[model samples]
Target: MTTPGEGWKTPELRAAEAQVDARFKQAQDLANRLRDTPLPPVPPVDFAAIARQVERAAQERDAPEQLKALKRKVDAGEFTWEDVVSGKAAQDPDVQAMQQENVNKMKQAFQMLREGMAADEIMAAQDPRRHRDDGDENPPDVFTEDKW
Candidate 1:
């Protein structure tokens, strides 16, 4: 009733082959699903915006170093909530100095803009993480892009 190699397979051998076929079919189905799956899109980075945010945070953290008089007064608790609430705190010499620094920085920025440079260009100039071209060789802004 059997033909060639089919006559040599015992019932146990036939059962094993059936199990192998079932597993192979399952594996193929899984591989097909994986091949058809779509990957998520990658988000683009705004390095200039990130640089601006970090610079702002650094300015706040550097207050103690920039405003020595302000730090001393703040540590001594000389100014009360009432002084701040009544707007007297704005008249402080240290606060005025800080305002002047901000004004000077803004002036320099405006001058750069008047020279036809973009805001992002100014930010990039100030960003230490940026790499520059030496006029002879072209380079990527971010050093991590060397592989490109």
Candidate 2:
């Protein structure tokens, strides 16, 4: 290799320098485009509040009396967690009401779904509106009155 001072000013060095200059220009152009482009606004979220709520829920579940009481209630009755929360055992009326509301909502949804399905089946069978006429397709020979 040529000495450092002499090599720095040579045509090869100038070419290498030019290449570096071009790369720098390209990088600057990319940076400029990135700067000009608009980005979506960050979501407004309370991470601290979410963390505190999670911690509180964990503490409530881990509390000695609460866990013991919950277990005692479970042992005393044939009840799931939902029943414990909603069935006359919940100390807090608000929690009881919320759980009962949830149970009622689920029951209502299930009943509505059953009714809807029944109505759909009934409509499909009785109503001529949505019924389609069969083209030339016929039953297989196995379904016909034939010797087994």
Q: After superposition, how far is residue 42 of candidate 2 from its true place, in Å?
A: 0.6
Relative to the true structure, how large is the alpha-carbon lDDT of every model? 0.63, 0.55
Off by over 4 Å in 1: 1-64, 80-87, 126-148
Write one digit per residue (lDDT tens) for candidate 1, span 28-142.
9999999999988988765556545533543553333435555566557876333432446778876677557767778888899999999888766655334355432334443
Residues 1-148 of candidate 2 have per-residue lDDT tens digits of 3455674487877788789999999999999999999999998765556545533543553333444444455555644344443344466444355456657756765676677756555555543333545431232332434433
Pick by TM-score: which candidate is best? 1
Question: Which regions of candidate 2 fall more than 4 Å away from where they truly are?
Answer: 1-8, 53-148
In model 2, the clashing pairs are: none
Error of 1 at 128 (Å): 4.9
Model 1: what TM-score? 0.37
Enumerate residue pairs that collide in model 1.
Answer: none
